[model samples]
Target: MAEPTLHIGRKISKVRELKGMKQETLASELGISQQAVSKIEQSADVDGEALEKIAKILGLSSEAIKNFSEEAVFNIIGNTYHDNSASLNYQCSFNPIDKIVDLYNEKVALLERLLQAEKEKNELIKSK
Candidate 1:
């Protein structure tokens, strides 16, 4: 079996895609070239400044990128330790993207409700 990769690039790419941002757009925002963005997303050892720029552009913290990985914990442990010491396993049920979407939707619903209430109040005042 092969070693698990950190997949920092994949995380960056995923965040960018979720935000509907193109590589060229991110590069332009960071004053870099499209190729630089591409390389950053593909390489695990990208420059710290570049990674910070990517995180800011994607509205994600650096810690988020640090924890990004495609491989499961079991796979990671198996690859790192075969028949050796004890291993730990963990599972994540919540997705960050889903949580973000839910929050945004909730905010929008609240705003709509407030607007409706305000409009009704205005109409009542006008009729008085």
Candidate 2:
């Protein structure tokens, strides 16, 4: 049976896709071939050292990639947008849509900060 833990390779692939990056780009960053990146993404497990390298290339922490969850993402979006207090009042043709875009941009920035803090904590723990 599978351990039900996060598959590191799959998470890597997901992040790469969300960032609009191709396997070849990741390979170039890692100084490996596209085929190598594809092979790496096939395995369920990646070495911790290699994972760290991949994380650096992907602009994420190794721990973040290992612990990434889609539910948490949806939860964030739901929490941010589901608040009626923050809801936009649409009186114009484009204002409401622009407000939606603003909300998403704000949420993405907030998430980035949180991710950076998590990375710092992980680094601190590693140094301890």
lDDT of each: 0.79, 0.87
Which candidate comes out best when scored by TM-score?
2
Name the runs in model 1 displaced over 4 angstroms: 1-5, 69-128
Off by over 4 Å in 2: 1-5, 82-128
Query: Which 10 residues in a row give candidate 2 its minimum summed lDDT?
Result: 83-92
* TM-scores of the candidates in the order shown: 0.48, 0.61
Each prediction's number of clashing residue pairs: 1, 0
| Model 2 TM-score relative to the real fold | 0.61
Kindly list the per-residue Cα lDDT of model 1 for residues 22-75, writing each as its tens digit. 999999999989998898887766678778877887788877776765455447
Residue 61 C-alpha lDDT in model 2 = 96
Question: Pick by lDDT: which candidate is best?
Answer: 2
Cα lDDT over the full model 2: 0.87
